[model samples]
Target: MIVVQNLIDAISLGSVYALAALGIGLIFSIMRLINFAHGELIMVGGFVIYALAGNPMLVMALSAIIVVTILALGMERLAFRPLRKASPPTLLIASFAVSYFVQHVILMIFGSRPMGVDFLSVLGESFEFAGLRVPRLQCIAIVVTLALMVGLVVFFRASRIGVQMRAAAEDFTMARLLGVKADRVIAVAFALSGILASFVSLYLVAQTGTVSYKMGVNMVLIAFVASVIGGMGSLTGAALGGFIVGIVSVSLQAYLPEELRPYRDAFVFLLFIAFLLWRPQGLLVRRASERV
Candidate 1:
C-alpha cells in the first residue's frame, strides 16, 4: 500500500513536470530557444489567482490564462523577435536576462513572502478506498495530464495550424519558404505554452498550498533538464524523461536512509550525469533529417 501510494505521488509529480516540459519543447522545436522565462508564466498565473482572492473558479482560470498568454506573446515580440537571427548563445543569454528581470519584478512588487493559495482547497483532500490511501490531487492531476496530452496529440495531428507548427518544428526556414506562416505558428506555440503554465500554476498551488515567485523556478529547472534528457526537440521524449525524473526523485525521498535524505538531489544529478555520458542524444529523438 505504501509503495502504491508512492507510485501515485510520483506519477502525479511527473505529470506536472511533463506538462511543463511540453511547453518548453514546443517553443524550442520551432524557435530553438529555451525560454527560461517560461517559469514566469507559471508565476504570473499563480499570482493572478492570488490577486483575485475568491473569484469564480472558471473565470479566474480563463483570466489568468489570457494574462499569461499575452505576456508570453509580448516576450516573444519585445525580447526575442529582434534577436531572431542571433546565435543560440545570445538567445540563451537574453532568456537569462528575461528570467532575472521578471523574477526581480515580482519580488519587488510582491516582496519575498509566499502568498497563500487557499483556493481549490478540495483538491488538498486525501481519501482511502480498498485500504489504499491516495490524494485527490494526485488522481486529478493524472487524469488532467492524460486528457491534455491526448488533446494536444489530436490538435497537432488534425488542425491546420498544428500541421504548420509541426512543419516549422522540422525546419523553420523551409517551412516558411513553403508558405507556412512563421509568426502565426510561433505565436500559437507561445500561447499553448502559457496555457500549460497556467495549468502548472493550478496544480502547483494545489500541491503546495502557497505561491511564491520562486515556485516556478525550480519546477521549470526540472522541466528544462527533462527536455534535454528526453531529446531537446522531442515532445514524447520530454514527457517520458519527466516521468523518470519524478519517479527517481520520489523514490529517493521515500527509500533513502533518513540521514542521506538531504542529499537526494545529489543522487538525482548523479543519474543525470550517467544519462549524459551514456545517451546524450536522449531517450528518444527525431531522425536527423526530421529534427530542427
Candidate 2:
C-alpha cells in the first residue's frame, strides 16, 4: 500500500514536471533556444498568487495566469524578439541574463523569505478513496493537469492556429513561405508556454505548501533534464520523461539504501547520460518526414 501510494504521488508530481517541460519544449521547438527565464516566469506566477492571497481562490488563480502571460509577452518583445537574428549562443546568454534579472527583481520586491497561500488548507480538507487518504488539492491537480494536456493536444491537432504553430516548429522557413505568420506563431507558443508554467506553479504551491523566490530555479533544471531525456522538441517525449524521472526519484528516495539516497541525482544523471550516448535522438524521435 505504501508502494502504491508512492506511485500515485509520483504520478501527480510527474504531471507537474511534464507540464513544465512541455512549456520549455514547445518554445524550443519553435525558437530553437532554451529560455532560461522560463522558470522565473513560473516563480513570478507563484509570487502573484502569494501576493493575491487575500482574494478569492478563483480570482487568485486567474490573476496568476494573467501575470504570467503578460510577463512572457514582455520577455518575448524586449529580450527574445530583438535577438531573433542573433547567434544561438547570444540568445542563450541573454536568456540567462534575463533570468537572473527577474530573480533579483523578485528578491527586491518580495524579499528572500518563502511565501505561501492558504488555499491548500481550504481545499485539502478531508478526502478519502478506497482506503487511501488523498488531499483534495492533489485530486484537483491531477484533473486540471490532465485537462490542460488534453486541451493542448486538441489545440495542436484541430485548431488552425495550432496547425500553424506546429508548422512553424517543424520548419519555420517553410511556414513563413506558406504565409503562416511565423512571428505570430512564435508569440503564441511563448504565451501557451507561460500558461503551462502557471499551471505548474499552482500545482507546486499546493503540493509544497510554500513558495520561495528560488523555487523555480531547481525546477527549471529538472524540467530541462526531462525535456532532453524525452526528446527536445517532442511534447509526448517530455511528458514521458517527466513520469520516468518522477518515479525514479521517488523510488530512490523511498527504497534506496540510506548511504545511497544522496547519490540518487547522480544515478539519474548517469541514466540520462547513457540514454544520450545510446539514443541521442531520444526515445521518441520524430521521423524527418513526420510532423511532431
Candidate 3:
C-alpha cells in the first residue's frame, strides 16, 4: 500500500512535469529557442491567482491563463521577435536578460515572500481507493493534463492553425512560402506554452500549499532535463521522460540511504549524461521532416 501510494504521488508529480515540459518543448520546437523566462511566466500566473483572492474558481482559473498568455505574447513581441534574425547565441542571451528582468519586476511588485490560495474550497475534498488516499486537486491536475494533451493532439492533427504551426516548426521559410504566417504561429505557440505553465503552477501550488517567485526555477531545470532526455522537440518523448524522472526521483527519496538522499539530483543528472552519451539525439527523435 505504501508503494502504491508512492506511485500515485509520483504520477501526480510527473503529470505536472510533463505538462510544463510539453510547453517548453513546444516553444523550442516552434521558435527554435528556449525561453528562460518560462518559469517567471508560471510565477506570474500564480501571482495573478494570489492577487484575485476571493474570486470564483472559474474566474480565477481563466484569469490565471489569460495573464500568463498575455505575458508570453508580450515577451515574444518585445524581446524575441526583435531578436529573431539574430544569432541563436544572441537570442539565448536575450532570454536570460528577459528572465532576470521579469524576476526583478515581480520582486518589486509582490516582494520576495511566498503566497498561496485556498484551493480546498475550490477543489472540494479528497477520496480513497483501496488503501490509498488521493486529493481532489491531484485528480483535477491529472485529468486536466490528460485532457489538454489529447486536445493538442487533435488540434495539431485536424485544425488549420495547428497545421500552420506544424509547418512553421518544420521549416519556417517554406512555411512562409506556403502562406503560413510564421510569426503568428510562433506567437500562438508561446500562448499555448503560457497556458500550460499556468496549469502546472496551479497544481504545483495545490501540492505545496504555497508559491514563491523562485518556485519555478528548480522546476524549469527539472523540466528541461526531462525534455532533453525525452527528445527536445518531441512532446511524447517529453511526457515519457517526465514520468521516468518522477519515478526515479520518488524512488531515490523513498528508498535511498540517508547519506545519499541529498544526491538524488546528481543521480538524475548522471542519468541524463548517460542518455546524451548513448543517444545524443534523445531516446525518441522526431524526424527532421516531421513538423511536430
Candidate 4:
C-alpha cells in the first residue's frame, strides 16, 4: 500500500512536469528557442488567480487562461518575433532577458514575499481506495495530463493549424514556403504553451497553498531538463522524460537516508548524466533535418 501510494504521488508530480515539458517542447519544436520566460507565464497565471481569489472557480480558471495566453502571445510578438532571424545564442539571451524582466516586474507589483492562496482547496483532500491512499489532486493531475495528451494528438492529426505547426516543427522554412503562415503557427504555439502554464499554475497553487514569483523557476528548469532528456522536439519523449524524472525523484526521497535527502537533486543530475552518456540523442530522437 505504501508503495502504491508513492507511485500515485510520483505519477501526479510527473503529470505536472509532463504538462510543463509539453508546453516547452512545443515551442522548441518550432522556434529552436527555449523560452526561460515560460515560467513567468505560470507565475503570471498564479498572480491572476491570486488577484481573482474568492471568485467563481470557473471564472478564475478562465481568466487565468485568457490572461496568460494573451501575455504569451504578447511575448512572442514583442520580444521574440523581431529576433526570429537571430542566432540561437542571441535568442537564448533574449529569453533570459525576458525571464528576468518579467520576474522583476512581478516582484515590484506583488512584492518579494510569498502570498498564501487557497485556490482549489478541495483538491488538497485525500482518499483511500484499494488499500491505497491517494491525493485527489494527483488523480486529477493524471487524468488531466492524459486528456491533454490525447487532445494534442487529435489536434495535430486533424486540425489544419495543427498540421501546419507539425510541418513547421519539421522544417520551418519549407513549411512557410509551402504556405504555412509562420506567424500564425508560432503564435498558436505560444498560446498553447500559455494555456498549459495556467493549468500548471492552478495545480501548483493548490499543492503549495502559496504563490511566489520564483515558484515557476525550478519547475520550469526541471521541465526543461525533462524536455531535453525526452528529446528536445519530441512531445511524447518529453512526457516520458517527465515520468522518468518523477519516478527517480520520488524513489530517491523514499529510499535515501534522511541525512542524504538534501542532496537528492545532485543524485538526480548524476543519473541524468549517466542517462545522457548512454543515450544522448534522448529517448526519442528528432528528425535530422535542419530546423530553419
Judging by TM-score against the true structure, name the best candidate. 4
Query: If the candidates were sorted by their lDDT against the true structure, best first, what order would they fall in?
Result: 4, 1, 2, 3
Q: Which stretches of candidate 4 lie over 4 Å from their true place?
A: 288-292
TM-score of every prediction relative to native: 0.96, 0.93, 0.93, 0.97
What is residue 207's positional error in candidate 1, in angstroms?
1.6
Q: What is the per-residue lDDT of model 1 for residues 51-153, given as tens digits with 9 covering 90 to 100? A: 8868887777778888988989988889988888888889889988988898899899899999886767887778889777788888888999999999999
Off by over 4 Å in 1: 287-292
- The candidate maximizing lDDT is 4
RMSD of each: 1.6, 2.4, 2.2, 1.1
Residue 246, model 3: lDDT of 84
Looking at candidate 1, the ten consecutive residues that score lowest on lDDT are: 283-292
The better candidate by TM-score, 3 or 4, is 4
Query: How many clashes in each structure?
Result: 0, 0, 0, 0
CA lDDT, candidate 3, residue 224? 86
Model 2 score (lDDT): 0.83
- Comparison by lDDT, 1 against 3, better one: 1
Clashes of 4: 0
Error of 1 at 188 (Å): 0.6
Q: Which residue pairs does candidate 3 place in steric collision?
A: none
RMSD of 4: 1.1
